[model samples]
Target: MNTIGSWQNHAISLGLPPNTPVKKQIDEFIRRWDNFR
Candidate 1:
């Protein structure tokens, strides 16, 4: 899955809205994953 999709999944797993400001947390997670890659 793409970053945005994976982010959405992370947010959903956390019971957050897909577009919630907390989605920033998901974006951070994606950033970390990208950095690791």
Candidate 2:
């Protein structure tokens, strides 16, 4: 998804790998947010 790509871009900008824990946590939060809607 475009939104996910943008989030990953944030990781790239931070000089971290694509699969960082911070990204994982953000993805989980997004999943919960979509469910909450």
Candidate 3:
């Protein structure tokens, strides 16, 4: 079965621009999520 990778998956689907401020926030979140490990 296929599964979504992460928020970045949805972000990619939505065609969010990499330079957008909101995308920057999500990028920060992904960074924090990794640091939690």
Candidate 4:
């Protein structure tokens, strides 16, 4: 998704790898937040 890509880009700008576990955690967090909303 474009939003996911944009988030990954932001993470990369902060020096994290796109495929890192931190990225996966953030993705999961967003998914849960969206579901809760």
Model 4 earns a TM-score of 0.46
Tell me model 1's lDDT, rounded to 2 decimals: 0.66
Error of 3 at 17 (Å): 18
Off by over 4 Å in 1: 1-21
Report the C-alpha lDDT of model 4 over 1-37, residue by residue, as the tens digit.
2455666665665456765566575776687679999
Q: What's the TM-score of each model vs. the native?
A: 0.41, 0.46, 0.44, 0.46
Query: What is the alpha-carbon lDDT of model 2 when measured against the actual structure?
Result: 0.63
Worst ten in a row by lDDT for model 3: 1-10
**What's the candidate order when arranged by decreasing lDDT?**
1, 4, 2, 3
Query: Which model, 1 or 3, shows the larger TM-score?
Result: 3
- Clash pairs, model 4 backbone: none
Once fitted onto the true fold, the runs of candidate 2 whose alpha carbons sit more than 4 angstroms away are 1-20
Write candidate 1's Cα lDDT for 1-37 as tens digits. 3455665566776566776565577576678789999
Measured by lDDT, the strongest candidate is 1
Separately for all candidates shown, the number of backbone clashes (residues 3 or more apart, or on different chains) is 0, 0, 0, 0
lDDT minimum window of 10 residues, candidate 1: 1-10
lDDT of 3 by residue, 1-37 (tens): 1154555554554466444465675676678679998
What TM-score number comes out for model 1? 0.41
Per-residue lDDT of candidate 2, residues 1-37 (tens digit): 2465665665565455765677575776677679999
